[model samples]
Target: MRIRATVAAVSAALALSAFAVPAAHAAGSTLDVTFSSMKVNSGKAITVGATSTVKVKATYTLTHPSGVSVANVLSGPVLYRGTSAKDADTQVVSDAPGTCTTVSSTTLHCSATITLPASDLYNADAGTWKQGGVAVDAKSGVQKWQNDLGTIPVRRAAKLTADATPEPVKKGGTITVTGKLTRANWETGKYAGYATQPVKLQFRKKGSSTFTTVKTIKSSSTGALKTTVTASADGDFRYSFAGTSTTSAVSSAADFVDVQ
Candidate 1:
């Protein structure tokens, strides 16, 4: 009787083990990349002229769904472009390194770095900046990473121009104007990738002598700045930012339509 009972117990234990489901992998969703700050000149793209330095840093968090190994590769070089057009108009900007560190069985951590070229950040390309955003090239190999929710969108809005639809304003009305500023990094200069001094924006009437001081804008963790101000009266308006020895170099005039 003892021998028979032992055999039946062993058989029942084996059967239960075979029927049980395997454990699921603890992978999370897609990767999440974000910038802490970014900056450029108030009017121009880069500060400190061609010799200026711009520092940019981003944090990347990778989430997985299963037990898949992600290749230790970084994101591509993104551009700081105007709002109007895309493609070739989009210049290739610098990026930081990307690496994966196992935060948990289902979570991973990584980073990206970018260094802007010298001349590209200094002068205006003589193009209408309708909008401003970032872009990147397709990864060299087949894409392994996919967006789980909406966490892994390709680009973020760095800066943007006012919309085509004009906002209503009373003639000679007091209205607020705001914008962000980002100084450029160096391509071929003494101080490269280091931030130039901050730039100051001065507002004025297009054809009039009257000028009013508006708020100053600075860069973000990604190297961009935004500012806003109110107008004393309505007319053709524009802004100018000249470089100080400690601040960014001169920037081209930016304009806005003031309506009655």
Candidate 2:
């Protein structure tokens, strides 16, 4: 649904001309252009929050025969969720052609931005996505696609909170810890409860820097968490989520408690 002008124009031409021709058959054609050193989002996971459009930068090296004039060529990187671009279930393409700088007589380094709108994405779309490159001759209508250049993880942003009751409690007394787990909902453009997920209760001593897991508990149907712990010492309590393929890992800020 986030298709851009360059992608739409090139895709239409490729469809009509059957642009899947292999590189070996591009002897005298503009399809001889090849892509290398392709990288998306600087090789980091792309995390999207509700309602915001995420733009990631992609860079690659393009090599072409000296005889081919690249002035008429449109090239950029794309992320897809299927075997190939033409057969992709969903794909994200750059809004414009890549800006290239000459590296040599036969090679150029290029970079472009791929925009992703949260409203256009589904929960199932969060996972490993294949990276590929596409090049099209604007005038000749010839195109070339290189699939499986690499992979990137696309995940929804997650959030967690923790609060411990009775800031100052007597030793051996019972303390209640409560929190919530939520994740970005692309469809509704909001942060919704992530129900029935396992979350960890962690404790860190006043003088220590490390937090040790005290227990693991599952969230309620509405993503609420509540547990009881014995107040033994002065420390901080927090919750942690390991995260799923569709969500990014997150931890809550620690709530400090004093034992009398």
Q: For each candidate, how many residue pairs have backbone atoms clashing (under 3 Å)?
A: 52, 0
Residue by residue across 1-260, what tens digits does model 2's lDDT show?
64323335334323233333343454465467999999999999999998878999999999998876787777878788888853576777766678899978899999988878898788778899999888877666667778988999999999999999898999999989999999999878999999999999999999999999999999999999999999999999999999988899999999999999
Candidate maximizing lDDT: 2
For model 1, residues 175-249, the per-residue Cα lDDT tens digits are 544333333323233322212324345555657676564544543444333444444444433333444333344
lDDT of 2 at 202: 99
Cα lDDT for residue 209, candidate 1: 73
TM-score, prediction 1: 0.32
Off by over 4 Å in 1: 1-50, 80-88, 93-96, 125-140, 144-260
Q: What are the Cα lDDT values of the candidates?
A: 0.34, 0.84
- Could you tell me every candidate's TM-score relative to the true structure? 0.32, 0.86
When superposed on Cα atoms, how far off is each prediction in RMSD? 21.7, 4.6
Candidate 1 residue 128 Cα shift, in angstroms, is 12
